[model samples]
Target chain A: MHEALRFQPVDAEPVDRADVVAKSRHLRRVTEGAARGLSLTIRGLRKAFGDNEVLRGIDLHIPAGQFVAIVGRSGCGKSTLLRLIAGLDAPTAGGIAFGEQPRAQDVRVMFQEPRLLPWARVLSNVEVGLGRERSSADAQARAERALVEVGLGDKRGEWPSVLSGGQKQRVALARALVSQPRVLAFDEPLGALDALTRISMQQLLERVWRDQGFTAILVTHDVAEAVALADRVLVIEDGRIAEDVTIDLPRPRRRGSAELAALEGEILKHLLEGSEDTSGL
Target chain B: MSLIDSLPRVGAPKLPKVDGLIPWIVPLAIVLVWQLACVTGFVPSRVLPAPTDVALAGWKLLLSGELVRNIWVSFWRASIGFVIGGGIGFAFGLANGLSQLSAKLTDTTLQMVRNIPHLALIPLVILWFGIDESAKLFLVALGVFFPIYLNTLHGIRTVDPQLIEMGRIYGMTDGELFRRVIFPGALPSIFVGLRFALGIMWLTLIVAETIAASSGLGYMAMQAREFMLIDVVVLSILIYALLGKLADSASRALERLTLSWHPAFQKK
Candidate 1:
């Protein structure tokens, strides 16, 4: 229909809720109630460590069930932004409003490090994600289901010490997923993984995002990753959003496809320009 | 990717079960040489009793019920003092480690007190508790307290902050955090403290019992010394060695049990 083409914006900033509202409508018609996400609206969000202001003011609106990637040079406050969104750290100024004040289990974070408890078995580690319902008797069943989702059900009884780097991160993903969170914030979750594992993990992440419909915000340094997985990619420069690019391409995006490569190149070019300007070179 | 690659690999070479007895050879040899030296008159029994003479003394004391009674008394005192000291030390460690305010209030005083050698307080302890069982108990308790306190505090403080943050993110209460993460993480260090405290516990008890009047392995040794019962004295020394080794083995067993999750404690 002409309506579908006319209503949806490709990508632009400042990213407005109108884009999200329209996109979600179009998405609901396409996927039909698949998303179980909470919309996040951040306004004038600022964070400072002592006098060094990291995030001057970040304004963002993530639509329910959208995948948003934040890419930046180191020290550009991408991780800090994820922390603020996840409620792990308070913003110095401005405010962030989730559509609802999410329940404790409704917001989960997967850190770059697996952070799985070495003392706890894989299944118990997943159960930890259940919060207050950890003792609810059916908690084990739910945790097992989550592990199976991550292809780690057979590893439930194994100690975390024995798991490989990729396996450990998978267990961490299971832990994050077990709670069925509405908004999942990832702080460079795949940064430590090898290239092959990173690709597969990306596929797994995409699959889960599609299946669960959680609003996922991934903070990373990889431009290709940003373009590959994100519906909208926000390039952070100088503590603010430099670009808000929407990848309108279809699902199961080919890794080496020209369209994906072009988007990746465009973002990388922008990042380099900003860096060059910063260094006055 | 093939099924053969996934098949189980052969493990390390198996040791014959008799390999367990390898360590016993030296002890047996030393005892044989000791008994032979006494038998050949190369060592005088009056000065250093033969192994058989010491065993005979042990048998006689066992018959008189004196040996069992003394050992039981020493064992009881050690257990009571260990429980009291270890309990208090563990309580203080938990408080100071978990709370900034508690550490601020007590840690400095504790550090200052820790520098004073606990055994040096014997004269003052005698003046205070008067050579009764209480005095010896106080010495043993004081001696046992510091190691547990230091180790427990260190253990709690050194639990991975990342895991603690993860626990908080997952919605663990303070009690749940301590129970599931902090305490278990701290246990290996606490075991280190336990082993150290056991050594000091025996050391303090020996000094206290020897210096005081009645009823323990040390007291028995002292009485035998007065009567020139060299064999009895030798038996006492051997008992102390046996007791120290026993305590160390017991703690190692406990550590193996509780810390099976640790990489170092995991069976090869």
Candidate 2:
């Protein structure tokens, strides 16, 4: 916070930029080394729909509390991987194991469509994320806390139909977070939002992840989003993890900064080449 | 919240209470023209009674308590028939909607029976049940069945699968999934079926009463026609119209009450 105030007057001060970056790392590291998130291990993760193999023999481990972004072209099985990780779909061949025997609410997925109940009030929708504990006394309080975390406290009584697209997604996020899942998977949750709203949503996602210390797996088509929010960006090509790049950047990364743009460009190059390699031949 | 506040909400303008009189104009004008024609000798009372004559007949029937008695009988028949038919239809609909085996076993046969008009079975129903209360019940129940069944099935089938999926992911059990996701999602279409059935309910009741009944508006109207009492017949017809309107209004009130969350039902 002090870093933002100090950098307020210096329009493009290079020293201010470095200091901001350094200060933001302090913001990020607050949750970086916490053991609050569960570690995920996948082995020979294979999925096929009929004869179509969407994912083939994927093996990877995500350490506890790391934010990972999966990026690829459409139909690249990035979402498929995330779904398998979140246990939304059963993997045909392999198994996924958390570091421990996680509870039912240990993992939650925020779908692209928000998937809110149109009949339910915003607070009730969030309370749904409490799973079987929904009937408990503190459920409403917990749901309210989650809503306030997403900056939607006033929307508690509003119907989901009345909300804007971005607000609905925020409600969905609050629902996902209400359960305090050790692993949160997002399936392009912000893809439907306007560009400016998408950026703000991305920041909200980052803030919640930092505050809660939960491992986040975001699958998206935008390479820039992958670099901007994730500690590690995994590139899936031809149903495989083609490249895994560790983004050692600081928190609160600027949208159009040199470091982020270069990483995004490099990932985009790999993605474009992967497209040509399959279709060109 | 600021963003939502800044966004323009979709709301229709509030309707003033005086606008309620707008719908009465055409009906009132028709009555005025009919009364004028009757008074001027343009139309004979033998063919059609004037509106005032019908009102006078209605007042006489009300003082004798026959109007209320017949209305009560008809209303009772409609209610009982609707409950029986709607209950059975809802059961079949829910079964078929949720279970593939149930749908496969009975849906084709039900569809075949549905294709045969229930009113056309009136003679057959009379033969089978001897023009008794059961015959009336059979006809009215049969008439009210299809709309509720078809719409209930459709509503259940069309519930957004994505919402169901989300419910499953959030650790909803089978019962929870149905109650929280499937049932509420199917409610709007179920209400549509209910309204349609209410219309059929009144139509079938009138026909059943006209066929053979000791009491009811239809019976009174038919009996008055036989005696050449034009005013009494017209009064019965008017009463039937009012009863139909009342049933329709009741169903609409229910839709508004339950479907308050629905955008189409909400008023500014």
Model 1 ranges off by over 4 Å:
A1-33, A274-281, B1-13
DockQ of 2: 0.70
In CAPRI terms, model 2 is classed as medium
10 residues in a row with least lDDT, candidate 2 chain A: A5-14
- Give the fraction of native contacts in model 1: 0.78
Off by over 4 Å in 2: A1-33, A274-281, B1-15
Q: Candidates' lDDT values, in order? A: 0.88, 0.87
Per-residue lDDT for B1-268 in model 1, tens only?
A: 4696577657745576968888889988999999999999999888898999999999999999999999999999998999888889999999999999999999999999999999999999999988899998888888899999999999999999999999999889999999999999999999999999999999999999999848999999999999999999999989988999999999999988878777887755
The TM-score of candidate 1 is 0.90
Q: Which ten residues in a row have the lowest lDDT in candidate 2 chain B?
A: B5-14
Q: TM-scores, in order shown?
A: 0.90, 0.91
**Of the candidates shown, which would achieve the greatest TM-score relative to the real structure?**
2
Q: List the residue pairs that clash in candidate 1.
A: none
